[model samples]
Target: MTSAPLAGCILAGGLARRMGGGDKTLLPLSGAPMLARVISRLQPQVGAVVLNANGDAGRFSRFGLPVVADPIEGFAGPLAGVLAGLRWARAHHGEAEGVISVAGDTPFYPADLAARLMEARGPDAGRIVLAKSDGHMHPVFGYWPVSVADSLERFLREGTTRKVLAFVNLHPNTAADFTPEAGAPDPFFNINTPEDLEAAEARARIEA
Candidate 1:
């Protein structure tokens, strides 16, 4: 943890075009809603948690987290969710230094995500921190400084590129590497399509 607390952002705002649309995160994994699994994993790692979704906030009301929508229109992607998280953190979690964003569709992200990223933050770093596994950077799972909220909004409004990496590159950032335990499913495994949901169900059964 830094000098201030950290908040969590569950980015459930995706259009899920591949999963045939709708909220893929709300789909059940095993017996519980997949979003529930994500909240359970992320809640323990932060001072507060909020859900980032586009519509029908009531659908997620059972989870008992504040729902924040992308501040920018046109569903500007995950970066917009990050901005929402940052703004929400600033307003509600004034004591929090930043927000740790994770995909709502990803059920098994590392438990130590917040710690690893905070640990990797050197003295010169008020920078954004991202998660990396198997040499692939998970941009959606990142540590974002609340102070960057304005800058992120500007980046989105510029319309140059809404890509997460494009904005990340504009600031000083680094990635924290995560290695799955032997014989365990990749920690970042997420449910996107029916096939991915099937795999998650199987993984959930084995873990159960």
Candidate 2:
């Protein structure tokens, strides 16, 4: 079945503590900024793409797309990024039924991700859809309904300290199972530290 079209969001507003204080999205991986590769992969799948980055949007202007900041402060993690994307989608692409978010540090995401995720959403509204691989769940790569703005806002205002999975557990979430291509490593690998960046480069070379 054909899935509903989605708005793609690259969650690039993190502090990058593990990779030093710089923006991990701008870091090079396999000769391309990690953010660029993510855009290239998602652009074809979604109706439109936006960067959810904070502080000085000019840095991402070269990408020639809208960059939005979290409505809440104190860097509330990926959930805040998700909220920003949902807000953008609602304002710009209100007709879009949902938004798909991927961390900027993850460049090797699956090609069929949007379809798989939208499929998992089923008939539910405000449902979260996450990807699972090798018995581990990658909550950062998922689809969320645009209607979540109010709940997310309330969570932020209430000073909720729950992690992404904990917040997700509060709602019904469908886990999409994806088997790695024969001999291919997991596609949702994320770069967090210097060692992870090196590993991603090597993996990219092998996949290329």
Which of the numbered candidates is closest to the native, going by highest lDDT? Answer: 1
Q: Return model 2's CA RMSD, one decimal.
A: 1.9
Pairs of residues clashing in candidate 1: none
How does each model score on TM-score? 0.95, 0.92
lDDT (tens digit, per residue) of candidate 2 on 13-123: 878898878899998888878888899889888999989999999998878989999888877888899999999999999877788999888898988888888877887
Q: After superposition, how far is residue 133 of candidate 1 from its true place, in Å?
A: 1.1
Q: Candidate 2: where is the Cα deviation over 4 Å?
A: 181-183
Please list the C-alpha lDDT of all candidates, in the order they appear.
0.87, 0.85
RMSD of each: 1.6, 1.9
The candidate scoring highest on TM-score is 1
Tens digits of per-residue lDDT for model 1 on 1-208? 3344899999999889999998898788878899888998888889999999987789888999999888998878999999999999999989888899999999988888898988876554368989998789899998999988999999999867888888888899988888666776789987778999998888889887
